[model samples]
Target: MGVGGAGCSAAFAIASSQGFQVTGCDIEKTSPYLDKRLKKFVSIGHDPAHLKNSEVIAYSPAVTSFDSDNEELVMARKRGLEVLPWDLFVAKELLKNKFVIAVAGTHGKSTVTAMVGVLLEKAGIDPTCLVGAIVVDWGCNYRVGESKYFVIEADEYSEKFLNFTPNIAAITNIEFDHPEYFRDFDHLKETFKKFADKLQEDSVLIVGSDVNLKNNNGKTNKVSGPADLNLKMVGGFNQKNAAIAAAVAQELGIEKDSIKKTLESFKGVARRFEFIGEEKGVLVFDDYAHHPTAISETLRAVREKFPDKKILVVFQPHLFTRTKVLFDDFVRSFTEAPVDKIILVDIFAAREKDEAAVSSLDLTRAIVGGKAKYIPSLEGAATYLVKEVSVGDVVITMGAGDIYRLPTRLLEKLEGKG
Candidate 1:
C-alpha cells in the first residue's frame, strides 16, 4: 500500500494480525505507522525494483505515480502472481471468515466505521473490526478476532466498493467527490445505486435521510424500504450511520436491545469531530474534514454540539486538486458556522501540484464571518495558537493529512504552561 493515512494503518493492522511476512517500501520512510509495521523490512525508500520478488502488488487509491511500477507489477503478472487493489483484497479475505459490516460513503465513512467497530468491541461483542482510525481498543486499525463478524470501513474511491458484495451497505450522502476520477454528480450517484443493488436481497441499505435515492429499488428510507426502523446512535450524521447498521442488525435478527446498548456506548472515531480532552477549560478536537462537503457537515455537527462555545478552527487544505476543483464549495463550507476565528494552513498537496492556482488564502478571503490566514507549517500554527486561543474556546484541528500533529503539539505546549 502507498504510505498515505488510512492505507498505511490498514497495512500495519493486517500484517500484525495475520503474522504474514511483510515488506514495505514507500516514499515516506519515517512514518511511525510504517516504522512500527515494517521495522525489520522497510526497503528504506520507494523503488519499483523491490517489487521484483513480490507475488502481487496491492496499492492504495492515491497511487497515481505508480505508472513507473507498472512494468514490475506486470512482470509479476507474467509469472501468474496476482496484482490486487487493497480494497478488493480486504473484502475477499474478510468474507472468508467473519460477519462484515462494510460502511460506504464519500465522507463521515471513516468516523462512522470507527464508531461501529469501537462500540461493538466495548459491548463485549468480541467482533473483529477494521476502521479508518488507529482504534486504541484494538491497538491498531485492524483487529484479529475469533468471532464470525468482520466489520470494515468500505471505501468509495474509484468505485472500490464494487469489489465487496456486502450484507449491509450505506450512503451517508450523495455528493460530487473525487473529481479526479468521476465525471459528474449523477455519475457518482448512479454508481452508488449500482452498489446498493449488489446488497443481499433480504439485507439492508442505509442512506442519508436528506438525499433522495432515485433508482434504489432495494431497501431505502421508505415505507417498504426499511426507513422507519429505530437506531440508537446519536448525532445527526451518526444517527444516519446507526440507522443503516441497525437495519442490518435487525435483518440478521440481532436483538434490538443489544444494538441499542452498542450505540449508547459508542465513543466515536479519533479525528472525526473527536474530542481530544480539555486543557485549562479549552476543549480540543480533531476532524477528518478534507473534502468541502465533509468540512461543512463536521462544522455543522460541532456547532450543534457546542451551541455557545467560541469555536476556533484550525483548517489545513488536503489536496490541491480538491481545493481547486471545489474552491467555491470550500469557501462556503464555513459560512453557516458562526465561527469565532479561523486559521488556514498551506495546502497539504497529496499527489497533486498547485497548477490550478488554488491556495488556502483564496478560501480565507471568501469566508465572511471568520477571519483566515495562511499559516504554512504545523509548528508555526501551533505556536500561533498558544498566544491567540482563549479559554472557553474550542480548538478544532481539521483535515485528513498530517494536520493532526498540529493539535497534538499545541496540546503539549499548552500543558507545559501548567
Candidate 2:
C-alpha cells in the first residue's frame, strides 16, 4: 500500500511489523519525521514507480481522492489491483468494535486522538488504537491488539470521517481550512453537519464546549459538555479538547474520576505546542500549527500561560498553496496575542509547487506591529534566536516541519552536547 502524511507512517509500521512485504516511498527523506524511518524505504522520486510490485494501492488524505491517475493509483487500477484508501481501511476497523471513540474535527485531531488512546491504555482498557500522530506511549501510530475498544482520528479533510460510524464521536472545534479541497466555510460546516447525521440515536457526540462552530462573523454556537467534563487545560481551546475527549471516554463507561485524572495528566502531543528543553536562559517550545486557526490557539495559549515572559516565535510556512491561500489570515491569527519577536523561516512546501508566488515574505509582511524578520534555514533561525534571545523569553518554533529540531539542537549546542 502507498500513503503519505501521518497516515502513511501507520501503514508503514503495520505492513513492516507484520512482514506484509511493504515497500514505502517518498521524495525528500531528510526531515525528522521522514528520516527517522529512512531505513525502511526505497524511492528515487515522488512517484510510485519503485513500488511496481505493490498488489493493491493505499492512499492518504493528502492524496487527492478525485485524481484517478495518482501514479500508484493509476498503475494499480490498470493492473486490475485493488485500491483501498486509508480512511476506508480505518473506518472498517472501527466498525468491528463495540466501543469505538472517533475523534473528529478540523483541528486538535492528533492531540485528542492520542490523548484518548493514552487514557484508555492507562486505565487498563487495552483498546486497539489508530491515531494520526505518533503517541509517546505507543511509539507508533497504529496498534493491533486483543480488545473491544478502538480509537482513531476522524479527519474532515475530505469528509473522510463520515465513512466511520463511531460509537462515541468527539468534535474538538470545527474551523474553516483545506480551502484547496473545499469551496467555503459553509461547505465545510455542511460536511460536519452531515457527519453528525451519521451518529447513532443518542449514541453520544462530544463536541468542544467553547468552539465557534460557524466561522468568521457567522453563527458561532458552542456545544456544552457533560458535568463530568468540567475540567480545564492549558488554553481555552485545549480545555475544550480535553473536555470532548473526557466526554467520549465517559460515554464508553469510563469512570468520571478516571476521565478527570487522565485528562489532567495529558501533557500534550508532539508538535502540538511541545516543550523542548531550554537553552541558557530562553525557554524553547515547538508546535504543529501550520494553519492560521491552529496558530491562533497556540499563540493565545502561550500568551495566557506565560504572560510575564516575552513571546518569541520561529514560524515556518507549510505548503505553498496553504501559505498563498491564507496569507493575510496567517498574519491576523496572531493579532489577539501579539508576540514580542518573530522569526519567519522559509516555507515548508510539501507536494505543491511554488506557483502561487508564496514566500516567507508574505507572512513577515503581514505580521502587524511585531518585530518579524526572515531567516532562510533552520541553522540560521536557531542562530538568530541565540544571538537575539534574552532571559525569560519564550521561544516557540512552529510548523508542520522539522523546525522542532532547531530548539533541541540549540540547547545541545549551548550544553556542548552537539
Candidate 3:
C-alpha cells in the first residue's frame, strides 16, 4: 500500500513490469512515482473494500509501522489472502532465479545501487534495477531490463534486507541509525553481520574501506575508488560509493573501461545534492541527508565546491527519535560544517509521535555560536530565506522528509510568483 513512498513506488513499478496487476493506495493523494508508474488507483486511505479484488497485498514499511491495524490489512487477514512486506515480496517473488546484486548499508546504498545498475546496463547486461531514489538517467527509481540479473537497494531498517539471498552485495559504510528500531550500536552492527551472512557461499560481499564487519561468510573485497577518477558528483563519500559499484561490476565480469565511463557520466539520483536552478543569482540545491554524518559530509562537499559563497542551510530533522537520540551529534554536525547561517524547521516526526522532550528549537539552541535559528515551519523558513538570502549565496534545503518541497517554494517566492 503506501505506494507514494520511494521504495513502495519502485516496488509497484517493478511488480507491474513483471506483469502483475498492481493497484495501490497511500495516505498521500499523489506522488511523482504514482503519477508516472501506478496504473490503478485504489483509495487515498486504507479501506477494507479495496482488497476484495486482490490476491496478494504488498505493503510498505510505513503502513506496517504506522497503521498496523489498518482495515486493508485486517481484511486481508480475514480473507486469508497472501500478505507480504514490499521487500519480502521482491526478494521471494521477483528475484527468483535471477542473479541478484543487493546493496545494503546505513548510507550511500541508493547511489551505489543506481551506479551498479547503470554499469551493468552499459556493459550490455540489461539488468533490472530498483533503487530507493529516482535515478536521473532513468527518469525513475526503477529500470526494467529483460535479463537474468536483478539489482536492488537493500534497506536495513526493520531488518528488511535479510529476506534477500543475494548472489553479490555491497556495504558502502555502517553507523548507528534508525534509533527507533535498534536497541544499541552493537545490535545494529550484529544486524548488519546477519545481513552479510545471508550471502551465498560463493557470493561476493564488496565493502568500503571504512566498513568493519566482524565476521562474514562470503568472500569480502575491500575497495576504494581511485583518488584521481574524475566524477561529476561532489564529495569523497560519492567516490567511495563509486568504488563499491566498480567492485560489483568487476565481479559481474564488466570491463574497467565500461565501468569508469558509466561512473563518470552518472548524473546521480534525485535529492542527493541535486542542483535546483539558480534564481536571482542564488544557487539552490536539495539533498536527502537526515543523519548527522551525511549532513557533515554533504556540507563539507558544498563548502569545498563554493569556498567563497555564503552557504545557508535550511534543515528539517526527519524523525523525533533520531533527533533525541543523536541530539548532540546533530548540533556538532552543523557547528563543524563551514556554513554561515542555519535555519532549523520543526521535526518531521514521520510515523512517530512527537517526543515532548525534543524539538527543532532544542537542536537550534544546542548549536554553538549565534549561527542557528529555529523557524518552526517550512513556509516560515522559505519566507525568511527569501528576504535573508542575497546574490551569490548558496542555499541548501536538506532532510529526508518534505523539506525537498521548500526549494521550489523558495524559488517561486524569489521569482515573485508565490
Candidate 4:
C-alpha cells in the first residue's frame, strides 16, 4: 500500500505495538522526513514482489498520489487477497474492538486528538492513539497501548471519517475549507451532520461551543466556559481546544486535576505554532495553518503572545482549488491579522493542478490595508526577510507545504550565512 503520511502513521501504530508483522512501501525510496521507526518495514520504491507474503493489504486513502493502479495493490487484487483502505481497516479491526474516541472538525482535529491522547496517557489509562500530525511527546504520530480505549483523528476529506464507528466523537469546529471535495459550504455542513449521525445510539458527541451541530441520536455535550487548565500553547484557539479535551476527559471519568496537569504541560504537536530557534533577537515559528480561519487565528494569537511586537508572515497557499475558491476570503483574513507585513509565496499544489488561473500575485494584490508583498519562492522570501526583520519582530512560516523549511534559511540569513 501507499506509505505516505497517513499510511506510514498507521504502519507505525501497528509496528510499535509489536502485534503484527507489518510491511509497507512508497513510490519513492526515501523521504527526508520519514519516521525513523518506519525504516525497517517500509522500502523506498514499489514492487509487486513486496506483496508476496502479505495476507491482508491496507492502503492509504491518498493512494492516488502514488499510483491509482499501484502494482502491489493490483497484485493483491489478482491474488484475491484481503484488501482495505487504512481508514476502513482501522474501523473494522481496531475501532470496532475498542471504545473509540474520534475527533472530527475542519480545524484543530489533530491538536485535539493529541490532547485527548496525552490526557488519557497521563491519567494512567494506556490508550491506543492515532493522530494526523506528530505528537512531540511520542516523537511519532501514534501510540500503541493495551487499553480498550482508541483515540483517532477523524478526517472529513472525501468523507473518510464516516468509515469509523466511534463511541465518543468530538468536533473541534466546522468551517468551509476543503473546496476541492465539497460542492459548497452547505454540503460540508451536511456531511458533518451525517458524520455526527454515524455514532451509535448510546455514543457521546462533543461539539465546540461555537459550533452548532444537529445530532439527534447521540448524547451531545457542547464545550464552553473557562477551564482550570492553563495551556502553554499560544493561541486562544488552543484554550478552546483544551476545553473540548477537558470535556472528553470528564466524560471518560478522568479526574479533573489529571486533565488540568496534562493540558498545562503539553508541548504541542509539530508545526502548530512550533517555535524555531531565534536568531539575533528575531523569533521564528513554523505552523501548519493553510486555511484562512487558521491563518487569522494564528496571527492574532501571535500578536497576543508578543504584544507590541511587529509580526511578519510568510504564507504559502496549499492548493490551487483552495486559493482560487477562497481568494477573497484569503485576502480579508490577512487584512485584520496582527501582522506588520505579509509575504505571499507561490501556491504549493499538493495532488492538484493549477486549472483555476489563480496565482499568488493575484492574492497579494487583492489584500487591502496590509503591507503585502509577493515573493514566488521561499528563498526569495528568506532573503527579503533577512534584510527587513529587526529586533522584536516575529516571523512566521505558515502553510501545509514545504514552506516550513523556510525558517532554517531564515535562521541562516539571520546568522549571515545566506
Candidate 5:
C-alpha cells in the first residue's frame, strides 16, 4: 500500500481507529518526510514478498504517478489480492457504516475538513475524521471516534471523491487547478456538478455563495455572510471556510453556541499558514499554496493579519506540467499578491519529468513589477533572504513541495547556524 499524505491518513485511520494491522510503503521509503509510524511498518522499496500475505493492497496517488506500469500492482493482480485505491477503501470500510460528511473542493477541502472535525469533536459528538492535512489538535491526519459520524476530505483529483457516499457534502469553492487531469474549465466544472448531483434526495449540499453552480436543485444551503464567531486566523477567505463549516455543523443539529466556540478556538492544520518560529525578529510562516488563487488568498490573508509587516514569499512550483500550463496564472498570482519580494525556487517535479521548455527563471522574468528573483537552490534562497530580510518582515515558504523544509533552514541561517 502507498503512504503519501492522503494514503498515510487512511492507513492511520484503519490501524488506529479500526485496529487493523497496517503496513505501507512509498517509492522513497527512506525519505526524511516519511511519517515515522509508516517507517516502522514500511519497507525501503516495493517487493513481491511484501504482498505475499496481504489481504488488501491500498494505493495512493504516488502509484498513479507512474501511469500504468507499476510492478507492485502487477504483482498484486498476479497474486489475486484485493486491490483498491485508498479513497475506495475509505468508502468500502468507513463511509459505508458511518453518517458520512464529505468536504470536496480544490482549495479549502483540507482546511474545511479539519475545521469540521474540530468543531464536531469540540461539540462532544466525537466523529471519526480523515482529513488530508495533519490536524495539530490530534497531532495526526485522522481521528477515530466511536460515533457514527465520519468526516473526510473528499478529493476530486481523478474524481476520487465520487466513490464516497456522503449524506452531507460541502463544496468550499470550485476552480480549475489540476491541469494534468482535467482538460479545461468546463470539464472541471462538470466533474464538480456530477459530485453535487450525487447527493441523495434526503441529503444536503453545503456550498459557498461564490460558487456559480446553476443546477444544485435547491438542496444546497449557501454560506453567504460572515460567521458569528471571532476567528483567530487571518484572511476573509477563512471567514468563508468558517461559514461553510458552521452550515455543516448546523445541519447535524450542533448548537450555534458550540459551533461558534469551536470555530473560533480551532487552530489551523499544519502547513496552512503554520508559523514555525521567529529568527532575529523576522517571522517565518509555511503554507501549502501552489495554485494561483491559493497564493493570492494566502498573501492577502498575511497582509490583513500584519498590516505593516513587509512580506517576503519564497514559492516552489509543485509540478512541471502545472507550471507549464498555468504559466500566465502563476505570473499573475505573484503580481496580484501584496508581497514585498518574491523568491522563485526550482520547480519540484512531483511526478512529471522536466521537458526543458519551462523553468523557474522564465516565471521570474514573466512576473511584472520587478519584485521577483530566481534562486536555483533552497539554501541560496535562504542565504539571499538572510541578508535582505529585515526585522519586521514575514517570510512565507509557499508550495506543496519539499520547500516546507526550507523555512527551518532559513531560520537556522538567520541564527548563524548554517
Candidate 6:
C-alpha cells in the first residue's frame, strides 16, 4: 500500500501496466514515480477504509516495520485478505512464467539492472524491467515490455530477494550492510549464497571477480576490469557495472554492437552521481552514496574527473545503526579520497531511533584530520556552503536522505534567489 517509495512505486506501476486495477496509499502525497508513472489518486495515509475494495493488499516494508499497528494492515488481517510484501507480490504474481534476470548485491545493482534493460531493449528483446532508481532514458523505474524476460533489481535487505528464482542473476559485489537486520558479514554472505543457489539448472550467474559464491547452481562467469568501451557515466564502479550488463547481454545472445551502443549512450539512473547543475563555475552533483565503500568510490571518481578542483562533500549518514556499525569505515572513507572539505549533517535515521552513542558529530570527531565539520541540519549546511563555496569548487550532496533537497537550495542561493 505504500506506493510512494521507489521499490513499491515501481511494483505498483508494473502491476498497473499489466492491466491490474491497483489502488495504493502512502504517508506522503507525492512522488516522482507517482507523478510520471501512476498518475492517479491514492489515499494520503493508512486507514481501514482505504482497504475496502481490495481483494489483496500489497504493502511496502517500511509500512509494516515503522508502524506495525497501521490501521490498513490491521484491517487487512481482520478481513483475512491475502496481504503480501511488494517483493513477494511481484515475484509470485507478476514475475511468474517469466525469464527473470535478477540483479543482487550491496551496490551497483540498480545501474546494472537499468543497463541490462536498456541493452535488451536495444537488442529488440523487449524485456520487462524494474530497477530501484529512475533511469534517465526511461524517465521512470520500470519498462513494461511484451517479452517473457523480466529484469529486476533484487534487494537483499530482510532477505526479500529470496522470493524470486531467477533464470539469470548477477552479483555486483558483496559487503556488510543493514546492520539492524543482519547478524554479521558471514550472515550476509550466506544469504547471498542462498540467493545464488536458487538459480535453475543451466542458468547463468555473473559475478565480479572478487565475489566467491562457491556452490551456486548455475554456470558462473567472472567479470572484471573497467569496460573497454567509452562510457558517458563517470567512475570505475560504473564501468564494472557496464561490464556485468555486457556479460548478461552476451549470455542472452545479444549482439556485441547493440550492447556496446547501449552502454555508451546510457545516461544513468537518478541520484547515483547525478549532475544537478552548475552556477558561478561551481559544479553541483547529487549521489546516493551513504555506505562507506560507495562514498569512497564516488569521491575517488569525482577527484579523478576534476583533479584540480576542490571537492566540498555534504554527507548525511543514512541510518543510525549503519553509522554506528560502520563508523570506522566511514571515517576512513573520507581520507581515502582527495576531498578538500567534508560537511557531516545529522544522521537520517530512516527507520531507527537516535542512538545515544552515535551521531554525525561523533563521526566528524572520528575523522583523522580536521577536514570534517558537523552541521546538524540541512538548512544550516546549505547556508554554510553558500557562504564558503566559491569558484572552481565541485560541490557534492552525498546521501540517501532528504539531503538531496539541499542542492536545489544551494543552487538557488548561488543565483541570489535566497
User: Where in model 4 is the C-alpha error above 4 Å?
Assistant: 6-8, 15-18, 28-34, 226-228
Per-residue alpha-carbon lDDT of candidate 1 for residues 57-91, written as tens digits (9 for 90 to 100): 66665554445455545565667877677676676
lDDT tens per residue, model 3, 1-418: 8888888888888888899988888887657665453645546888887886799899988997797788889889889999989888898889989999999998899999999999998899999999999899999899999999999999999999999888898998889999999998899989988988888778888888878763255588888553346899999889888889999999988898888898999999999999987999899999999999999999999999999999999999999899999999999999898999999999998889884979999999999998999999999999999999888999998999999999999999999933
Per-residue alpha-carbon lDDT of candidate 2 for residues 198-303, written as tens digits (9 for 90 to 100): 7665456666764443322222224585333433346667766676676666656789788778777666666667777776777888788888888887788888
Query: Residue 301 of candidate 6: its Cα lDDT?
Result: 92
Model 3, residue pairs in steric clash: none
lDDT of each residue in 98-193, candidate 4, tens digit only: 899999998899999999999999988999888888788987778888899999999998898898778899998999978989999999988898
Count of residue pairs whose backbone atoms collide, per candidate: 4, 1, 0, 2, 0, 1
Could you list the CA RMSD of all candidates, in the order they appear? 3.8, 4.8, 1.5, 2.1, 2.0, 1.3
lDDT of 2: 0.70
Top-down lDDT ranking: 6, 3, 4, 5, 2, 1
Clashing pairs in 4: 28-44, 29-44
Compose the digit string of candidate 5's lDDT tens values, residues 49-73: 7886788887877666865667888
Instruction: Tell me the whole-model lDDT of each prediction, alpha carbons only.
Output: 0.68, 0.70, 0.89, 0.85, 0.83, 0.89
1 or 2, greater by lDDT: 2
TM-score of each: 0.84, 0.84, 0.97, 0.94, 0.95, 0.98
* Candidate 2 vs. true structure, TM-score: 0.84
Q: What residue runs in model 2 are displaced by over 4 Å at the alpha carbon?
A: 1-4, 14-21, 28-53, 61-72, 92-99, 200-202, 210-233, 412-418
Q: Rank the candidates by TM-score, best first.
A: 6, 3, 5, 4, 1, 2
Worst 10 residues of 3 by lDDT: 33-42
Runs in model 1 lying further than 4 Å from the true structure: 29-43, 48-53, 66-80, 97-99, 118-126, 200-202, 211-234, 277-281, 415-418
* Stronger candidate by lDDT (1 vs 5): 5
